[model samples]
Target: MSWSLKIFNKFPINLSSSIHARAFNSKAIGILGVPFDKGAGTRGTDKGPNALREAGLIDEIKHISSNIDVKDYGDVHYELMNTNGRKIHNLNDLSDVAACNKALADQVEKIIKDNRMPITLGGCHSIAIGSISGVLRTTTPDNLCILWVDAHLDLNTNTTSPTGNMHGMPASLLVKELRSNWPTIPELEWCKADLSLRNFCWIGLRSIDYYERIMMEQYGIKYFDMRDIDRMGIDKVTNAALKAINPNGDRQLHVSFDIDSLDPLFANSTGTPAGAGLTLRECLFLMEEVHRSGTLSSMDLVEVNPLVGDVRDVTNTLNSAKAIVCAAIGSNRSGNSS
Candidate 1:
C-alpha cells in the first residue's frame, strides 16, 4: 500500500488577488524532511515525513496559498545501529542525530538568511532542535522567539530523562546542554547561544516531569499549561504565545508543533499520546489565530508515528496537516481594507 499525494493537489489556491500577497512569494517557504525516530520511547515515527508527503501536503499547501513558493529539500541522511537486532537506548546514536541535525540546521540557516520561511516535517519531536537551531543561527539574538506547542514539557536533560529518549531532551538541549560534542558547524554558527531562554515559550503542557518543571521554573521560561488554556481559552493562549515570541510584533517567530499535544482521540498515532489534551477544533482555532499574527516566520510539524496507528490515524493526521496549512497560508478577511 503506497501513500497518495494526490489527495492534497486538488485545492490549488489562487493568488491573483491582493488579499494574500505575503503568502505568495515563491521564494518564501522551504520544506524539509527529517526522518529520524531515535528521540521517541517507541519506534516507527521515522516514516512520518514521507507519509505526510504522500498524503499530498505540498499541493494542499500551495492550493491554500496560491502564491506560496514551497520547495521540498528531501530527507536527512542517517545510519542506525541495532543492538541484538533491536533498537535500544544508545547514547552513541546521538552522534548520528547531531550530524543529521547539523546538516539540517545549515539548510535552515541558508533559507532564513535568504529571507524565506522554512516549514520542516519531522520524523520525531527531537528534530525540532536542528530545525529551530538552524534558523536561529541566521537571526540576531534579540530577534529570536520559539513557541513550543506540545503536551509534554520536553525539558529533560540526558541525566534527568526517565526513558533516555532524546525527544524528551530537545528543550533541555536548547537551554542547558553544554554542546561539547555538538559543536558549532559552519552552516549553523548563529545557533550557538543566540537562541536564548528569553526567546522560548511553552503552550499546551500537561504531562510535565518533576525535573522538567524544575528546569522550566528555575530558568523562568513562560509556559501555559492546559489549565491555563481552559481558563484563558485557545484564542487568548495563541495571542499570549505570539506576544511572547514578538511582544511588539517586530521580530520573526518560529512555531514547533508536536502532534501529541492533541488529545489521543484526535491524534492517536503519535509516539507519545498524552491523554487530556487539546481538541481538534481548539487546535484549528489556535492555528488560525497564529495565521493572523503576521510574525509566523517558520514552522515545523513533528512526531506523527504511523506504524502503530489504526485506519483513522492517517485521516486525522491529514486533518492536522490541513490546519497547519490553513494557519500558515489562510488570511483573515474579516477586517481587511479594500
Candidate 2:
C-alpha cells in the first residue's frame, strides 16, 4: 500500500547525487526532471533540466538548508513515435508527450508517498499535466490548490488552441470544468481531470489570448497580471492569491511557475518571452511567502531554454530559475536566517 511500492515499478527512481548526507537536513525534496519538449513548438527546452543541474541548483539549495535531503530522480526520457493517425491540430507528438507525462505522474506520486516534497524541472509547461495529476493521486482534489505563475493563461483547449502546442492547454486538461470542451485524445486518456476552478489561481500573467480571457472571465478564475502586480505589489497579490485559493490554509499548494513569468529582462532564455512581467524581487518574494506558509507540497519550474540565448542570457535565466527554486524551498538571499 506504500506509494513507492505502488508506483516505483512503473517509474524507477534514479538518484544522481548524494549531497544530502553532508547537509543539515530538515525535509526531503524530490527532484524529478522531465526532459521532454515535444509538448511545445520549440525544441530547446528539452535540455532545461540538465542545464539547471549544471548550474548548481542542488548545491545552491543545499547551501540554504543543508539539513534538507535532496534526491534527484534523474530525467524521464520519451521515445518519439509517428503520429500519422492523430487528429489533434497543432498538438505534435501527442503519444510521446502522454507517455512522458504518465511516467512523470508516477514518479511525482511516489515521491509524495515517500513523504518528500516534489520539485519538477520541466521540459515545457505541459509537464504540469503530469506533475499536478501526480500530486492528485496522493491527496484529494479539493485539498489541493494550484498557483500558476505564467505570462500566458495556458487555458486553451484542443479545439480553441491557436497553436496546437500541448503546453498551452495543460490548465484546460487538468481542470474538470473544461473536460467537456476537450477533444477526445486517446493518448491523454490516462490524465485525470482532478483540479477544480476554485482550487486554481493565476499570478504574473500578461499575454493571454482572447478566448482564454473569455474562459477566465466565464469561470471567474482569480488571476493577477503584470498591471495588477504593479497596482497592488507582489506581497499584496500573493496574499490575495493564497487567501483566494487556499483560504483555510489546510490545502496543499502546488506552484507551477513558467520562467517566462519573469520579465524578458530577467529571464529571456525561455521559448515564450513576454515584455513586462514579474520582477526578480517580486518572484523571490512570492516564493518566499509560499515557503513560509508551509503549504507548498510540490512545484514545477519549467521552460528555461538555454540553447536559445547567448552565454550571458543563459546565465541570467538559469540564475533566475535557481533563485526562484531556492526561494520556494526557504532560501534567504538577505543572509538573515528566519
Candidate 3:
C-alpha cells in the first residue's frame, strides 16, 4: 500500500491535512524537551535536552526540509525531592518521575493533536513512559509500533530489576501484557497503556539483563541485536524490523532511541556505554530507512550526558545525535533534504 493511503486510513479526521498531506502540503515539527532525570541513577542526564539544543539540533533539522515548520515547547521541569531518610522500594523517585511524565504526556498529546510530528529530547530513557503514553492518548495503541534502539533492553520491571532505576524499567511498565506480572506500584497507575508486545521491535541490544533476556524469549519479542546486525547486516536487520513491527504498513512509528545504542567509541557520554554496538553509519542508515518508509510519527533521543566526558568526547556524541535526527527527518549528506 502507498504511504498516503496507510496514513489516511488510520487518521481520517484530517483526511485533507493528515501526515500524508503534511509530507507534501505542509511540514511542521514539534519539539518537547524533558529535563527531568530522577528516573536515572546519574545526575548529569538532566542537562541533555538543552545540550542537544546548544549543539544546533533545531538548525540542522530546519535544513532537512525547506518548508518545515518547527515549534519548540521548552523543557518540562520539576523540583527535586529530598529522599534522604526515606526507604523507596523497587523504584526510585517514583512520585517525581510520575509527575514529570504526566506533564510530558499532556504536552505530547497536545502536539500530536495539533497535527505536528513530535520530537522529544529526553533526560533519560524513562521519559519514554510519558512520551509513549502521550502518543497513545492521541492515537490507538494497536495502531502504533515502537522501534526501541538501545544497548540494553529497558524491559526490567520492579520485580526483575536489580537496581531500582526507573529508567531501566520503562519498557516493562509500558507493556500492558506485563501488568499482571508486574509488582503493584501505585505511582505508575496512570502510566498504563495497551501496548502489545508484537508492536515493539528492539535493535542495537548488547547488554540485556538476564531476566530481561528471559522475558524477551518467553514473550517472543522481535529483536535484532548487535550480533544479528553483524551477521545479517544493517539493511537486512532494518527491513526485518520494519516488517515485523508494521506488517500491514499502516501503523504509526515511534522511535525511542538511546544514545548508548551507539558503540562506546562513538558515544561515551551516556551513563551506560555498551561495546560492540551499532556504528554511527549503521545508526544513520537505520533512521534514514525509517524516514523513507514514511511511517514515523514521533521520536525520542535520550541518555546524552554532557558532563560525563571531555569537551571533544561530548562534541562528537552531540554531533552524532544531531546527525541521527537529521537522517531520521530525511536529510542527506549529498545535499538533499527529503
Candidate 4:
C-alpha cells in the first residue's frame, strides 16, 4: 500500500526492488491453478495460471500485506478420460472436462476444509463447475450465493450451445434446476447439480445466446447487463445484485469473474473479448466492495488466454487480473504509510 504500490498499480515496472510488505486485513488464501483448457476452443488458456505467476501475481499479493498468509497448492492435473472416439453431440471434450473438474473439486474441498479461502486460477470459464462444486461440498447450497461476472451468460447446455464448447455450458451444469436439461453423461457423474439459480446473480453480461436469454426469463434469474450498469451506475447495480442474492447479508458469497467481463480495449488477451464491457475502475470497485462485505468465501478468476494477443495485451490483462484478485482479497486504494 505504499506510494510505490499505488504507482505499481499504474506502472507495474519501475518500482523499487526493496519495497516492503504492507499491513492489510488478515486472510489465509489458498491458491490453485487449473491448466486444462479443453473446455474452450483456445489452446493457450491452459497457461493462464503460470502466466499470472510469471507476471508476479504471488509476489504482488504477498506485498499487499504482512498479515496475509498465502499458500500455493500448485496446478491441478487431470488426464482426459477414454471416450473410444464416440463424442456426444454438441459437447466437445466431455470426458476431459469431466476429468479435470472432478479433480479440481476434490482439491478445492480440501483447501476449504483447511480453513482457507480458495482462490482458483482458470484454464477457462468452465472451471467454475469444479470450484463451485467444491464449495458446495462444505457449505450448503442454500447458505451460499454467487456473483457471476461475465460478458456472456455462459448458460448454454449441450442442447443449446452453437459452438459445442463445454466452457459455455458450465452455468447450466452447476444449477440444480437445469439438471433435467442435461442428458446422462457417464463422465460427469462426479458433478451434481446442487446449487439453484435462485442463489445466483450475474453482472456485466453483454453477449447472451437466444436460448440463454429465454431461459433467464423463464427461470427469473437475477442479472445486470452492460446497459443496466450504464443506466444505474456500477455502485448501485452491484449493491442491487448483492441485495437480490444475499438479502439480509447472511449468506456466504462466491464470485466467479471472467476476464472477458472487461472491455477488449483493456483485456484483449482473453479468448472471448466483448466490446463495451466493464472498465478497469468499475471492475476493481466491484471486487473491492465484495471484499468489504466480509462474506466472500471463494472466487474464480478465469478466461485469461495468453496466446490470444501480443505481449502488451497479455501484460495489461494479467495486471487487471492480479488487481481483481487482490481487491477481492482486501487490497485497497489507500497506500501503506511510508
Q: Go through the candidates in order and give each one's C-alpha lDDT.
A: 0.69, 0.83, 0.82, 0.85
- Backbone clashes, candidate 3: 0
lDDT of 2 by residue, 1-338 (tens): 32212322232222232111111112789998988888898899989999999999998877786577898888876654455677676676678778889889989998888788999998899999999999899889998899999999899987788888889989999989999987787878879896788788889888988899888768767777787778667876777777777666778889999999999889999998999888999999999888877788899999999887799999999999999999999888778353
Q: Alpha carbon lDDT of residue 5, candidate 3?
A: 26
Worst 10 residues of 1 by lDDT: 1-10
- Per-residue lDDT of candidate 3, residues 138-209 (tens digit): 778898999999998899887788888999998888888788877665555678758998799898888979
List of clashing residue pairs for candidate 1: 4-54, 12-63, 13-63, 24-67, 26-69, 137-190, 137-191
Give the C-alpha miss distance for residue 60 in model 1, angstroms.
0.8
The candidates, ranked best first by TM-score, are 4, 2, 3, 1
- Compare the candidates by lDDT and give the number of the best one: 4
Per-residue CA lDDT of candidate 4, range 179-235, in tens? Answer: 999888878888889889988888998899999988877887778888778876887
RMSD in Å for all candidates: 10.0, 10.1, 6.7, 9.2
Which structure among the candidates has the greatest TM-score? 4
At residue 332, candidate 1 shows an lDDT of 33
1 or 3, greater by TM-score: 3
Per-model TM-score on C-alpha atoms: 0.81, 0.90, 0.89, 0.91
Worst 10 residues of 4 by lDDT: 11-20
Minimal lDDT window, size 10, model 3: 17-26
Q: In candidate 3, list every pair of residues with a backbone clash.
A: none
